[model samples]
Target: MRIDLHTHSTRSDGTDAPGDLVRKAKLEGLDAIALTDHDATEGWDEAQAAADEVGLRLIRGIEISTQFEGLSVHLLGYEFDPTHEPLVQELGRVLGGRNDRLPRLLDKLAGLGMPLTEQDVLAGARDAAAWGRPHVADAMIAKGYIKDRDEAFRDWLVPGKPAYVGRYSADLFEAVRLVCQAGGKPVIAHAWARDSGTKITPELLAELTEAGLAGLEIDHPDHDARDRAALAAIADDLGLAKTGSSDHHGTGKGPAFHLGANLTDPAELERLLA
Candidate 1:
C-alpha cells in the first residue's frame, strides 16, 4: 500500500487546505496519508472527513516543533488523540510562542532593510492560524523581499539571521512523551539534510530513542544518497525505524516528490500502526 506519513496543511505552514491535500492524495493514488499539521489539530477533523469522502485511510498526526540541545527539531506524532490534555497544553505554549515571534521577526526584517509589513504577511497567510515562515516567505515573494523561500532563509529567516526569533519548543524527550501519552507514535521528521547541514547524528537519535523516539525520517527532498546511507546505518545500529517519505509541501518546494518516492519498505508502516 502507498502511504505517506508526513505532510502539512494551511493549518500550519503548508500551502493547501486539508481538503485540497486529500484531493491531491487521491489523485496520486495514495492508499493513505497523514495530515501532520504543525502544533494544531483543528485541521484533523476536516482532513478525516475528506479522507472518508475519498476512501483513503487517514492517520491522525502532527509535526510539533521542539528543541534539543538548543537546536530546533520537529517531532512527528502519529495515531494520537489530538485533544489529549497534556499534549494540548504543550502545543498551546508552542503556538503562543509562534504567535509572538512572527511580529518580532517581521520587525527584524524591516530593520534589516526588508520592506515587509504584518498586514502583508497576515493577508498572505490568510488561513495559517498560527504565524509561520512560509507565510512570511509568501509575503516576501510578493513584495520582492528576497527572490524566493531559499533566498528569504539565506538572508533573514534562518537561525541567527537578522529576522530570526526563537519559539517555545519542547525538548526531544518531552515531545516523545507527549506523542506516546496522546496514543501516538513519535517519529523524527526529515533528519537527513546534508546541503544545509541538518544531519541527525546517531548519538542524538540514541538519546531520543532512549526517551521513546520511534523512528527517523530518512526520506526528504534535502537528503542525498550519502545522507540516506548514514540514516539507514544509524537506524540499524539503534534498532530504530528508517522511513521513506516525500515531505511534500505542494509546489515551489522543488520537484514535487510523491507519496512513495523514497519508501524503502512497507513493513515499518504496518509495524508502526500495529
Candidate 2:
C-alpha cells in the first residue's frame, strides 16, 4: 500500500481545500494520505469524510511548530485526540503567535517597499485555520511581488530576511511529551533540512527518543539521498520508526513535490500506527 504521511490543506497553508486535497490524492493513486495541516486539526473531519468516500486511509495529523536551542522545528503528531486539553491549548497558542506576527511581517514588507495589506493576505489564505508566511507569500504573489512561494521565502520570509519575524513555538521536549500524553505518535518533520539540521543532532534524537518521540521523517523533498541515509542510520540506532513523505503543499510548493513523490514503507506505517 502506498502511503504519504505528511501533507497540508487550506486548513493551513496548502492551496487545496480539505476535501479537494483528498480527492486529488485519490486521483494520484495514493492508498493512504495524512492531512498534517500546520498547527491545526480543523481540516480533519472534512478530510476524513472525503477519504471515506474515496476509500483512502486517512491519517489525521498536525504539523506543530516547535523550537529547540532557539531554532525552529516542526513536529508531526499523528492519531491524537484533537480535543485533548493540553495539546489543544498549546496549538491555540501557536496559532495565536502566527496571527500576532502578521502585522510585523507586513510592516517589514512595507519597509521594503512591497506593502501588502491584511485584506490581501487574508484573501490569499482563503479558509486556512491558521495564517502564516505561506499565506503572506500568496498575497505577495497576488500583488506580483514574487513569482512563487520559494521566491517569496528567498526574498523575504526566511530567517534573517528583511520581512522575517519570529513567533512563539512549543519547546521541543515539551512538544514531544504533549503528543505522547495526547496518545499520538510524535515524529520530527524534516529533521535535517537546511540549517535546522544543526539543532537535530544524533545526540538530540536519542534524547527525544527517550522523551517519547516515536519516529523521524527521514525521507522528505528537503532531504537528499545522503541526508536520508544518515537519518535512517540514526533511526536504526535509536529504534525509531523512519517515515517518508512528499510534504505536499499543493502547487504552491512548486514542482519539487507531488503526492507519493516519496512514500513510507508499509511496515513503517504499521509501526507508527502501533
Candidate 3:
C-alpha cells in the first residue's frame, strides 16, 4: 500500500483545509497520508473524518519544532495521544514562539521597505492555529514582493537572512522522550535537509536513537541521492525505520512537494506502525 507519511493542512502552513488534503490524497491514489501539521494537532479530527469518508488511512501526527545545539530540528510524532499533557504544553510553547516572533519578523521586513500588518499575515494564515513564516511569505506573495514561498525564504526569511527571527523550540532529546512517553513513534523529519545535515551527523543520530527516536525521514524533496544514501546507512546501522513522504503543503509549497511525490515502503510502514 502507498503511504505518504508527512503532510500539512490549513490548520498549519498548508493551503488546503484538512478535509481537502485528505480528499486530494485519495485522488492521488494514496492509501494513507499523515497529517503532520507543524506544532499543532487541531486538524486531526477534521482530517480523520475526511479520511473515513474516503476510505483513506489517516496517520494522526504532529511536526514538532525543536532545537539541537542551537539549530532548528523537526520531530514527527505519529499515533500519539493528542491529549498527553506534557506534549500538549510543550506544543503550546512552540506555537507561542511562532506567534511571538511575528511582529519582530514583520518589523524587520518593514525596515527592508516591505511593510505589512498583522492582519495581512493573519489573512494568509486563515485557519492556522498560529502564524508562521509561510504565512508571512504568503503576504509577501499577495503584495508582489516575492514570486513564491521559496523565494521569500531564500531571500528574506531563512536564518542569516534579513527578516529572520529566532523563536523558542523544545529540546530535541526531550521532545523524543515526550513522544515516546505519549506512546508514539518519533521520527526525524527531513533530518539532513536545509543545511541541517551539518548537525545531524551519524553520531547525533545514534545519540537521538538512544533518546527514543524511532525513525528517519529518508526521502524528501530537499534530499538528494547522496543525502539519502548517507541517511540510509545511518538508519540501517541504528535499526531505525526509514520513512518517505511528500511533505505536502498544497499550494503553499512548491509543485515538487505535491501529494505522494515520495512514498514509504509497505514493509517500512508496517514496521513504523508495529
Candidate 4:
C-alpha cells in the first residue's frame, strides 16, 4: 500500500533512466510509484513498460514548473491525457523555455569565468525530453567545475548565484485549470518549501482549491514537522486530498531521497485518483 507519487528519471532531471527507475521501485518494495518527470510525459511509456515487467503499479504524471506570486511552484499532474491539446502546447512552451534559457545561463557562467557550451549541457542531457538547470549542473559536473548537483546549485545555478537565469513557467492558476481540463488531478508539490509556504497561505490554498487543485503535498523531505502539520490541517479544512512523496530525483539529489521514503496514504491516493 505504499505509494510514492512524485519521481523523475533521465527523461528529466533524475539520474536513473525510466526503466531503471521502475525496476528500482519494484526492488525497493514500493507498491506504486509515479514517474512525475519535469514538464514531459516522454518517460511514461518506458516506465510503464518496465512497471509491467516488474509487476509494479505506475502512475503517469508530470511535475510542471509554474509561477505563483513571482515564486517558483511545482504542480504535480497525475493520470492526465497526454495528448490533450492545451496541456501539450503548454508543455511545449515550458520545454522551449528550458531550452532557451540555457544559452543565457551559459553566457552568465562564461561571464563568471566558468565557461560551458550548449554542447556540454546537451551531452549531459542525453535523451532527456526537456533540458533544464539540472542538466546544466550535470554538465558542470562532467567538466569537473563542481563535484555534484548540490554544489552546482549552491555555487552557480540557484537564484542569486552568478549563473542563475530566470525562465518561463505557467501561471499557477492556469496550470491547475489545465490539469483539470486535461482530466488530471493537480497537487501542489512541496507547497511549503523554501519560503513558498509564506506565499502559499491557507487563503491561497483555498483559492487554488476553487481553481481545481485537488491535493496538497503535505509530506516532503523539505517540509518541517510544523509545516507538514499546517499543510495537513489546511487540506482538511479545504477538503483537499493530501499526498506525500519522496520527490526522488535519483542519487544526484542526495542520500536522503529514496523510493517510498515519504509515502502517500492509500486513502489519499484513492481520493487523488477519484
- Residue 190's lDDT within candidate 3 is 91
Clashes of 2: 0
Worst 10 residues of 3 by lDDT: 192-201
Per-model TM against the reference: 0.93, 0.98, 0.98, 0.97
Decide which is better by lDDT, 3 or 4.
Answer: 3
What digit string (tens of lDDT, one per residue) describes model 2 on residues 61-81?
999999988878899999998
RMSD of 1: 1.7
TM-score of 4: 0.97
Residue 47 of candidate 2: its Cα lDDT?
98
Report how far off residue 184 is in candidate 1 (Å): 0.8
Which 10 consecutive positions of candidate 1 have the poorest summed lDDT?
256-265
Residue pairs in collision within model 3: none
lDDT of 3 at 67: 91
Q: What TM-score does structure 3 among the candidates reach? A: 0.98
- Expressed as tens digits, the lDDT of each residue in 109-167 for candidate 1 is 77887768888888877576598887888898998767878777777777767787777
Give the RMSD in angstroms, all C-alphas superposed, for model 4.
Answer: 1.2
